[model samples]
Each structure stands twice: as structure tokens, then as C-alpha cells.
Target: MSTLSIRDLVVSVETEAGAKEILHGVNMDISSNETHAIMGPNGSGKSTLAYALAGHPKYTIDSGSVTLDGEDLVEMSVDERAKAGLFLAMQYPVEVPGVTVTNFLRASKTAIDGEAPKLRTWTKDLSQAMKDLRIDPEFAARNVNEGFSGGEKKRHEILQLELLKPKFAVLDETDSGLDVDALRIVSEGVNRAKETTDIGVLLITHYTRILRYIKPDHVHVLVKGKVAEEGGPELAQRLEDEGYDRFLVNA
Candidate 1:
């Protein structure tokens, strides 16, 4: 089974104030079919961890290691990380001015698989996947995330997740700007991807609303760049009611 193991990961970021550490020895392991949630207050370095995992170049790994199914991701480039079955759906997906959604998706698939998928099969699958996500058929011709609403962009992220079928996905604040309806739909798409591909999820969010739809096997509360608490689904409910005040206070 595919597995991702992060051990004592210490990350730093360059700021106007110079290099400052964000993540402080984060330790976690996730295998296929498992859902792990990282919840914390704003500026708690939650998004930093997500970006670090995806090798964004901004976050530097000062110490520790990240391994996927025994391969060292800490030594891999961004695209190398993706080829190793790692995926990150950004909170704000950037627009590709001239690349149509169709071309982008197919190109991404080809990159991941090292060979182009049969055009006929990919076409059918893409159509069905969009329909399932309730996306407009005409969207295939539009540039990626171009002219799309917040909810549409979020759904597009899921579409990539569903199509790419990565072994692990780090969804960073995917619910940030989504409404109730859009949240439900995106959450359902995540569940579908999990069930269909047994993909491990490292869901990072500040609110528990997304947890209401995508149940997590493990919930970790990141406080001041460290895990202050961790529990099952019940912990998420507690976080919803009590907020991160208790953790922050104790920290």
C-alpha cells in the first residue's frame, strides 16, 4: 500500500525579516485510504506545511525527511514529487491564459503516467467526471481557472484530483470561499476520489464544516507550528465548539 511518512520536519521561510522557521518538527504518517486533517488558527503555519510538502520553493526544508512509499521526497523536485504520487490542490488555483482545460488535464495526465492516455477513453472519462462534478460541458474549452467563480475554481481543483488520482492529496483551505452547496459538492468529490482510488488525504482547514462532510480518521491541531493535540473525529467536533483557544492557551 502507498504510504507517506513525515518525520521531524522543520521548515523555514524567507521574509523581510530574513529566514524564519514555520514548521517545528511535525511528525505524521498517512497510508492509502486514510484521511488525516490538520486544523489550526490563522498564521499557525498550516498552509506553510502544505506548501512545503509540495516543494513550492518558497518554503525550505531545513531538517528532517519526507518519504512516500520508501522514496525520499525531500530530495525530489516539485514535478518529481508529483510523479511520486503527491498532489496539492492550492487554495487559489492560478489561471493558465492560453491553455484550455482539456489540454491542461490531458497534459497533466500524460506527465504523470509517462504516456498519453487513449484520446477516446480520456474524452469519455473527462466528460463523465465533469458531469458528475456538475461542471458545464463548455468549461472544457475555457482556460484553466480563467473566468471561473470561487466555487467553480474549487470544483476544478477536485476535477484534477479525480482525474490525476494521486496517491496522496493535501487540500489547503479548499473550503475557504465556498458556499454550503459548493462545499457539499466538493466534499462529495473528495469522498468519491478516496473511495474510487483509495487515495490518502491530508486535509488542512481552519473550520470544522468541511470535516462534517469528509470524515477524518485522525485530526491534528497545529499550534505555533507544533501539534498540540490529536484525536479522532470527536476532536474535530470539540474544535468546532471550543475553537483553538484552549490549545493556544495551553501552548
Candidate 2:
């Protein structure tokens, strides 16, 4: 059964000129324990799809419905969506200078789960997760993403995925701007998250490097704001070998 479903989704953004359509009748179904990768060139509306799925205010859903585990996701607020088992790891993680990572995690857990994590048990789990991700313990006490490097910011996003364990996660370009080592670490964290939970993954990326580590069960080509093509993992290899020209032509 699909954990998340987007049916005939149409989204537009408001600009000074007028409403500009970004997604045009796109549909997808992601199932539990499945990893799906959406790949497309720049301006193909990949990130727009992610934001739209998360119910971002900027991207207006012109029509269609989005459901999470058969629940109406389109009607829920962003925080409600999170509480309803949907998570979006953004392309650009925001930095808050005053909020420590520990505090942020606790608050998010409380908000999503309806109560704060028990101090003794939650901290132990948090420490173990940090250690597993190779993040220093002291980093938790520091402000969230404030002084973090690009890779560190990505790791912090993964940390939340681990702690929160949402039912479905839309990771927008999680592999961007990371060195080889950081990529592996981040991939490992993603793998760990999958092992610990039955979360479905929708990874949006341009590069194929991350796929080498975190193999996708399915690969989709997004072009002209829609899925131009889709196939098993071999489709990702074809894109890696031959580039997107063939797909663009069909798109």
C-alpha cells in the first residue's frame, strides 16, 4: 500500500507578473520501505514538488489531492503535516542562532509526538544517534545550523529524520555540496534511519553520486514539471551514462 500519494497534483507560484504554474498534473505513489529518487535538470520543478508536498504556503496547489496513509494531507497545516507523519528535509536548512540542537529536537519531538521525550532516555538515544552519525556530542548544545558547514547542515537534517522517524520523508537534494566523506556519512545516516523505521523515502537529487551509496528502488525523471519517465534502478544508471537528453526529448 502507498504511504504517500499525490494524485493529479497541480501547483503554481505567484510572481509579480502573475501565477506561474510549476507542477502540471503530476502523480506519484510512494510505499513503505521503498526509496524513490526524482532526478531532473535545474528548473525542472523538483524542489517545487517537494515544497508542495509539504504544504508550503508559497506553492499554491491549483488542484488535486495529496494523501498520507489515506489521510488528507493537503488540508493540514505544515506542522500538522509533520505531526501526521510527513517530513521534508529541505534543500537549504535554515539556521537559528539562539536555538540549540537539543532544544530544537526536544521541542519538535514534543510537538509531533504530543509530549516531550523523557530526559534520561531521550538524551541517551540522542547521544547514541549523534555518535552513530559521527557528530560530536558538544555539537548538540550548539545553536541549530548556526555555525554548521554545508555538510554539517545536511547531517543535522538527517539527525532530525533519525530522531523524529516520520512515516514519509521528502529529501530535497540531500546530497548536494557534500564532500566524499560527508556523503558517505550522510548516506549511512539515511540507511540507519530506514533500518530503524518503515519510513518511505522520496529523494530529489540531480547528481547520481548519492545513489551509489543509497540505492533507490525506483528512479523517476522529472522534466517540464512532470515525470517524463520512470523505471527501476537501471533508469538511474542510464541517466548516469547517457545524460538527460533522451529523456528531455520525450519530455
Candidate 3:
């Protein structure tokens, strides 16, 4: 089984006041087939940890190391990290104006795999994944995320997750803006990817509702950019019942 390890990770971002640290010594190890949920309040560095793992230029690694299976992820370029089997589903997916969804997914698959998927197999898989996500066939022709609703954009993110087959996925608040129906659909998509590929997941979210559907193997509460508590799925239930009130006070 592959492993994604985060050890004492310290990350920062530029602000009007200059460099400001966000994540403070965050650490976790996720293996294939394991799901870890990161629950935190707003500005608690949940997204910062996600983007830092994905090597976003906006976030700087002040110290610590991220490795996938033994290779240094922090040393790799963004695309290089992706090629190394890392994926991030952004909280707010950006619009790619001129790129059709079909073209974008196909090109991304090509880039990561280093070869174009055979036309027949590629077409079949693409059709199946889109249908599974309940995305309209017409979406294949539309520009990536352009003019799409919140649910539509989120579905498109899962579409890439399903197709790209990454080893590890850090989903940044994917449950946000999803209605009940959309939530179930998207959750199913995530579960499908995990079952099929044994992909490690670091799911970042505020609410425990998504946990009900996704069933995290482990739950971590991040307060003030640090892990305040860690436990099994029961921890998520407690967070739901008690909320982060106690943790915020301690933070």
C-alpha cells in the first residue's frame, strides 16, 4: 500500500503585513484505502494544508516535509506532484474559459499517464463516469466549469477525481454549497473512487454531514492551524454534537 506522510508541516502565505504562517506543525499519515477528515472552523488552515500539499504558489512551506510513498512532494512542482499521484479538488473550482470538459479531462489524463488513452476505452470510461456523476452528456462540450452552478462545478471536480485516478486526494470543502441531493451524489462519487483505487483521502470540511455519507476512517480537529484532537469516526460524531466550541476556546 502507498503512504502519504505529512510531518510537522509549517506553511505560510503573503499578506499585507508580509509573510504570515498558517499551518503550524501539522502532521498526519494517510495510507491507501484510508480516509482522514479534517474538521475545523474558518481560517483554521484547513485549506492551507490542502493547497500546501498541492504546492500552490500562494502558500509557502516554511519547514517540514510532505512525501508520497518515499518521494518528497514539497520538492516537486505542482504538475510534478500531480504526476506523482497527488490531487486536490479546490473549494472553489476555477473556470477554464476555452477548454471543454472533455478536452480538459482527456488532456489531464494524457499528461499524467504520459500517453493518450485509447479512443474507444477513453470514450467509454468518460461516458460512464459522467453518467455516474449524473452530469449531462452536454457538459462534455461545455467549457470547464464555465457558467456552471455550485453543484455542477463540484460534480466536475469529482469527475476529474474519478478519471484521473490519483493515489491521494485532498478535497478542500467539497461538501460546501451542495444541496442534499448533490451532497449524496458527490459523496457517492468520492466513495466510488476510494473503493476502486484505494486512494488516500484528506477531506477538509466544517460540518460533519459529509462524514455521515463518506465515513471517515479517522477524524482530526484542527484549531488555530494545529491538530487539537484525533480519534476514530466517533470523534466526528462528537464534533457534530458538541461543535468546535470547546476547541475554539482552547485554541
Candidate 4:
């Protein structure tokens, strides 16, 4: 089984004042078909960990080791990391004005596979995925995420996850801004990916509602850039009921 290992990962970002560290010595291990939910308050370095894993330039890896299987992910470029089976679904998906959804998906698929997908097969897969996600077929011809609603953009992110079929996906607050129906649709897409590809997921969120749809194998609570607590699925329910007050008071 594929494993994504994070060990003592410390990451920082440049600010006007100076470089400020965000993640402080975090460690976690996720394997194929395992869903690890990262629940934390705002500024707990949840997004930092996601971007750090995806090799975002803004988040500098001060020290630590992140590996996919045995290869070091810290040394790889962002695109190289994608090719290495790491995918990050951004919290706020940016719009690509000139790139249509169809073209962008095909291009990304080719990049990760190092070969283009056959047209007939690719088209059918794309249509089915979009349909399953409740995305309108016309969305394919539109520029990627251009003028799309919050739920639409989120669905687009999952669409890529379904088609690209990465070994691991770090979903950074994917449930944010999604309504009940949209959330269910998006969650189903993630579940579909896991079932079909055995994709490992690092699901970051503030609520347990999504966990109801995509059950996590493990739950981690982050406070002040450190993992404050870890447990099984029950931990998520505790967080939902108790909130992060205990963790915050202790932090």
C-alpha cells in the first residue's frame, strides 16, 4: 500500500515583518484508502500543512521530511510532486480565464500520466464524473472556475481528483461554502475516488458534517501548529459536540 509520511514537519511563510513559522514539528502517516481528518481552528496551520505537502512556494519547509512511499516529497517541485502522486485541492480554487475545464482536465491528466488519454475514453469518463458530481455539462466548455459559484468551484476540484486519480489527496477545507446538496455531491466524488483508486485522503475541515459522508479512519486535532490530540472516528464526534475549546484553553 502507498504511504504518505510526514515527520517533524516545520513550515513557515514570509511576512512583511519577517519569516513566521506556521507548522511546528508535525507528524502523521496516511496509507492508501485511509482517510485522516485534520480538524483545527483557523490559523492552526491546517492549510500550511496541505500546501507544504504539495510544495507550495509560499510555505517554506524549514525542516522536516515528507515522503510518498520512500521518495522524499520535500525535494520535489510542485508539478513533480503531482507526478509523484500528491494532489492538493486548494481551499479557494483560482480561476483560469483562458483554460476551459475540458482542456485543463485533459492537459493535467496528460501531465500526470506522461501520455495523453484516448479521446473517446477520456470524454466518456469526464462526462460521467461531471454528472456524478452534479456539474452541468456546459461547465466543460467554460473557463476553469470562471464565475463559478463556491460549490461549483469545489465540485471542479473533486472532478480533477476523480479524473487524475492521484495516490493521495490533501483536501484543504473542501467543504467550505458548500450547501447541503452540494456538500453531499462533492463528498460522494471523494468517496468514489477512494473506492476506485484506494486514494489516501488528508481531509482538513472545521466541522464533522463532511465526516458523516466521508468517514475518516483517524482524526487529529491541531492547535498552535501542533497536533494536540489524535483518535479514531469517535474523536470527530467529540470535536463536534465539545468544540475546540479544550484544545484552545490548553494551547
Candidate 5:
């Protein structure tokens, strides 16, 4: 089993007026077979944390280190980090005009795993995953997120997670903009992935609705780029009742 560790991680972005820090010495660890929920309001650097962890170029690491199973992740490129067993499902999944779902999934799998899957077995696996996620087989022929609804896009992300089978996944606000039915389907997909792969998940969200379905192992309240409070599932309930006011003050 692999573990993702972040220690005293500080991230900054280049601006017209020098560097602007977004994350402030954040620290956390996620292990295989565990799920961690990061809850915070807008502009609290939740997305920045996701991007930074995924090795996005725009976010500069000012200090500290990110490692996976004792391997240094900060020294790797985005593709390298992905090959090292990290995945990020973006909050806003992009529309790639000419790429079909099948091609994209195959390419991503090849890049991360260093070997192409056999066509016959790959198709069967893809079909089963799509069915589990309640995605239509026709979607495999369509362009990636080109005309997908919010929930469809989210499901597509989960489909990638299922097919890629990464060691750790950071879902960046995937519950956002999804309708109730869509939310349930998406949540079910996530649950299925966790069950099948023993994958570690860092679910980033602002509300507790998704938590109700996924049942996080740990819930953390992130305020002003820091984790202000950490606890079990009950912490998500308290945040739902009290909002971030208490945590914001403490942060």
C-alpha cells in the first residue's frame, strides 16, 4: 500500500507584483484504503491545494515536500507524478474537441501505466465501468466533455478514475453543480472505485451532501489555506449545522 505525505507545504503563484502565497505550511497524509474530505469555502485555497499536489506548473512550491511512498513527488513533472500513482479530477473538466472518450482513456492509461492494455480486455473493462457509473456506451464515441452536462462531466471524471486505477485520487469539488440524481450516481461511482481499488481519496468539497453518501474516514475544515479542525464524520455534520464561521475565526 502507498501513502501520500505532505509536510509544511507552502505554495505561491507568480503575479505581476512578485510571488503571492496561497497555501501556508499545509500538512496532511493520505493512505491507501482511506478517504479524506477537505471542506472549505471559496478562495480558501482548496483548489490550490489540489493543483499543487498534482504538480501544476502555475503553483510554485515555496517550501516543504510532497512524497508518495517515500518517493519525492515535488521533483517530478506532472506526467511523472501521474505515473507515480497520483490522479486529480478537475473541478472544471475541459472539453477536448476531437478526442473521443475511448482514445483519451487509452492514452491516459498508457501514459500512467507504461503499457497499453490489450484491446479486447480493455473494452470489456471499460464497458463494465461505464455501466457501473450509469454512463451510456455511446459516450465512448463522443468527444470528451464536449457536450456533456455537469453531471455527465463529473461521471466522466469518475470513469477515468475507475479505468486508470491510480493509487491516490484528489477529487476537486466533483460534487459541485450536480443535481441530486447525478450526485447519487457520482457518489456511487466513487464508492465503487474505493471498494474495487483500495484507492486513497482526498475529496474536496464545500458542503456535506457528498459526505452523506461517501462517508469520509476523516473530515477536515480548511480555512485560509490551513486545516483548522480535523475529526471523524461527525465533523462534517457540525460544519453543516454551524457553517465555517467558527473555523474561520480559529484559522
Candidate 6:
């Protein structure tokens, strides 16, 4: 089975004030058939773990290891990691000027597959994916993320997840800024990807609303950069009902 193992991961970032630690001794495991949710307060390092997994150069891995099956993912470059079956849906997708959505998606798919997708089939798939995500067909000609609303940008990320079919996806606060309807659409897209490909999901979010639609198999409460507690969906319910005050108090 394909599995992602993260052990005692410590990460830091450089600022004008010098290096600032984010994730500290964080550990988790996700299998292809599982969906894991990480819930935490603001600045509790949930996003840090996501960015670190994607090999963002800004986040320095201070120690520990991340492995996919038997291969060392921490040693791989960003593109290498993508080719190795890793995907990260960023919190804020940036604008890619002068590139159409169709070309961008096709190019990325080519990069990971080492060959171009069959034009007719790729077109059909892209069209269907956009329809499933409720994206406008005309969006194919627009530059990626340029002039797109927040919902549209987030939808594009989920669109990539569906098309790329990564072995594991780190969705960093994907629920943020989405209204009820938009959140449901994006969550549905994620569920579709996971069911079709058996892709493991490392979902990072502060609220449990997204969990209502995604239904994580495991829930982790992150506090002060480490996992303070973990359990089944029941844990998420408890956190939602009572809030993270207890966890924050301890921290």
C-alpha cells in the first residue's frame, strides 16, 4: 500500500528577525485510502507542515524525515516531489500571467507523466473536470488565477488535484474564505479525487465545517506546533462544540 510517513518533523523559516520555528516534532502517517485532518488555531503550524511537505524553499527542514513508501521525499526537489506523487494546494494560489488554464494544466500533467496527454482525451477530461467543479468552460482560455475570484482560485486548485491524481495531497486551509456553497463544491471535488485514485489526504484547517463534507478518517488537534491530541471524527466534533481554548491554555 502507498503510505506517507512523517516522523518528528521540525521546520523553520527565516525572517528579518532570524529563523523562526514553526513545526516542532510533528508526526503523522497517511495511507492511500485514508483522509487525515489537522485542526489548530491560527499560527499553530498546520500550514507549515503542508508547505514543508511540498518542499517550499522558504521553510527549512531542521530535522526528521518524510518518506513515501520507501523513498525519501524530503530529499527531493519541488518538481521532483510532484513527480514522486506529492501535491500541495496552496492557501493563496498566485497568478500565472500569459498562460491559459488549458495549457497550464496540460503542461503540469506532462511534467509529471513524462509525456504529453493525448490531445482529444485530455480535452475531454479537462472539460468534464471543469463541469464537475462548476467552473465556467470559458475559464480554459483565461490565465491561471488572474482576475479570478477567491472561490474561482480555490476551485482551480481542486481542479488540479482531480487532474493530477497525486498519491498524496496536502490541502492547506482550503476551506478558508469559501462560502457554504463554494466550500461544498470544493469538498466534493476532493472527495471525488480521493475515491477515484485512493489518494491520501493531509487536510489542514482550523474549523470543522469542511470536515462535514470531507469526512476525515483521522483528526489531529495541533497546538504549539505539535499534535496535542488525536482521535476519530468524534474528536473533531468535540473541538467544534467546545473550541480549542483548553489546548491553547496548555500551550
Task: For candidate 3, give the lDDT.
Answer: 0.95
Q: Alpha-carbon error at 108 in model 6, in Å? A: 0.1
TM-score of each: 0.99, 0.98, 0.99, 0.99, 0.97, 0.99
lDDT of 4 by residue, 125-145 (tens): 999999999888999999999
lDDT score of residue 50 within candidate 3: 90
CA lDDT for candidate 4: 0.96
Ten contiguous residues with the weakest lDDT in model 5: 242-251
lDDT (Cα atoms) of all candidates against the true structure? 0.95, 0.92, 0.95, 0.96, 0.93, 0.94
lDDT of 1 by residue, 1-251 (tens): 89999999999999999999999999999999999999999989999999999999889999999999999999999999999999999988999899999999999999999999999999999998899899999999999888999999999999999999999999999999999999999999999999999999999999999999999999999999998989999999998888988888888
lDDT of 5 by residue, 119-219 (tens): 99999999999998899999999999999999899999999999999999999999999999999999998888889999999999999999989999999
Score candidate 2 by lDDT.
0.92
Q: Which stretches of candidate 5 lie over 4 Å from their true place?
A: none
Candidate 3 lDDT by residue in tens digits, 61-138: 999999999999999999999999999999999999999999999999999999999999999999999999998899
lDDT for predicted candidate 5 compared with the true structure: 0.93
List clashing residue pairs in candidate 5: none
- Candidate 2 TM-score over all chains jointly: 0.98
**Against the true structure, candidate 6 has what lDDT?**
0.94
Q: Give the Cα error of residue 123 in candidate 1, in Å.
A: 0.4
Pairs that collide, model 3: none
Candidate 6 per-residue C-alpha lDDT over 1-251 given as tens digits, one digit per residue, 9 for 90 to 100: 69999999999988899999988899899999799999989989898889899998889999999999879999999999999999999999999999999999999999999999999999999999999999999999999999999999999999999999999999999999999999999999999998899999999998999999999999999998999999999999999899999998888
Worst 10 residues of 3 by lDDT: 242-251
